[model samples]
Target: MEVRELLAQTHKLPNVPDIVRELIQQLNNPNADYGDIADKVIKDQTLSLKILRLVNSAHFGLSRKVSSINEAVVMLGMTQLKTMVIASGIAGSVKEVDGLDLKKFWSDSFRVAALAKWYAEKSTGVDPDTAFTVGLIHNIGRLLLHITKPKLAEAIQTLVDQSDCSRSDAEMERLNFTTPEAGQALLALWQFPENLGDTVRYHRQPLSAEAPSPLCATLHIACYINAAIGKQQPLEEVIAMFPSAEAELAGLPANIAAVSEEAMQIESGLDGLI
Candidate 1:
């Protein structure tokens, strides 16, 4: 099926909570009342519980436990709270698939988010939170496919495992579209900012983007870093595979020897996120 057709199927697919959409709109309002945002989240007990659980988890490193949605908002700030809400929403959407290791999927995604945020922070003008948000959700298309097209998703995974090919190539061969494209379509359908949608869309081929984005290039670097670290690749190999080209485009340093260590650190950050 085409990207649009896949997107159309999302009406029946589960991902973000309805409260997240409201939270996004509220966050965009200049006159947004913090109380209203807190109240909105509290109304969704499932999401509220998830947020509290995440904040209290060691990953957040709070001195005191967060007991309520309002407390979480106050402690995390609106922007940070929004990020967690989306994170929790995505977590709730993940359903058990026959062959998918859901824990590993989210662990890797969190690794990318933490690494992307690290690179974005080092870059001149990129928002670290924006980078984190995109990194966390960039592979959402895979989740989407697992929900709607389990057999096809299974086949694509098998192709990647057996053929020593990239996931993008396997997806294109099986489904005629890459996860990035599906991710872009899903982001647009969710009414996320156009920039975020574009960032997800061209992350696999940042140079091919209509306008080269620091965020996109950062994502590319982050993905490479995550993969390299997870696979325990050598330092020289990591540099050759990641950072060199993508970091230049992102205005980051070419040396990526230390980034593997940074990526390793995010495994802890993934603690409550999954």
Candidate 2:
């Protein structure tokens, strides 16, 4: 399929659920009231309940702990709220891609989000919470793409593993659409901030000079390292992806991305706690 055909076809894609739309809009607005946001969250029985559970979960560092939606909002702040919103939407939103492995995907996404958050804390341009969420959702387009075009998804996977090709480029060659492109489209329809959608669309192509979101560039590097560490992509391919990202992240700290075996063990312990 030509890239133009894929773009034209995806126009008919479905929008995210109403709850995500509302959540994204609220989060994008810096002036949105927390009380009002809390009210909207509480109205959704499932979301409200999940927020409460997540607050009490070991993953969160609550000063005094929480047992209700209101408490979660006050304790976690907007970024955490946004994370839960994405998580809630994620739980029920996606359909499985027959050839894909959900467990691996979640593991990689979670680890990447964590790693991204750690990196964000050391950086100046990005927000820790937002970076974490970005890492988690960076490849979200791949999920929808997998469902919409499983054969192509499978072929992309095979090419990624067998050949020394970057996942996005291989996908583009096969499906005529990168995961970022699909993700950007989906996020826009869901009413997410255009910056987030744009980041998702261009993370792999950060050198496009036309790229505007520094946050997206941050996310792209985090994901590049994330996939490399988890044995999800070839190291050589990861090296190939880093030059533009290196340029994007000039100055600041020179942090090496590859996590050690001990790091994996640390992540495993943390995962059990989360």
Best by lDDT: 1
Model 2 worst lDDT window (10 residues): 265-274
Looking at model 1, which ten-residue stretch has the lowest summed lDDT? 262-271
- Across 1-274, the per-residue lDDT of candidate 2 in tens digits comes to 6434434556444345576666656554568665666677778787676667667766555677687776676676756676666655554455354787876776677777766666666666777766666776777788766666778888898999999998877977887767788887767655677777877787776657384566766766666566567665555565455545443462225434333222233241123212
Question: How much does candidate 1 score in TM-score?
Answer: 0.86
For model 1, how does the per-residue alpha-carbon lDDT over 37-135 read when each residue is reduced to its tens digit?
667788888777777887888777999988987788778887777777766777667667556788888878877887888888888767777788789
| Residue 184 in candidate 2, Cα distance off native in Å | 1.9
Per-model TM-score on C-alpha atoms: 0.86, 0.75
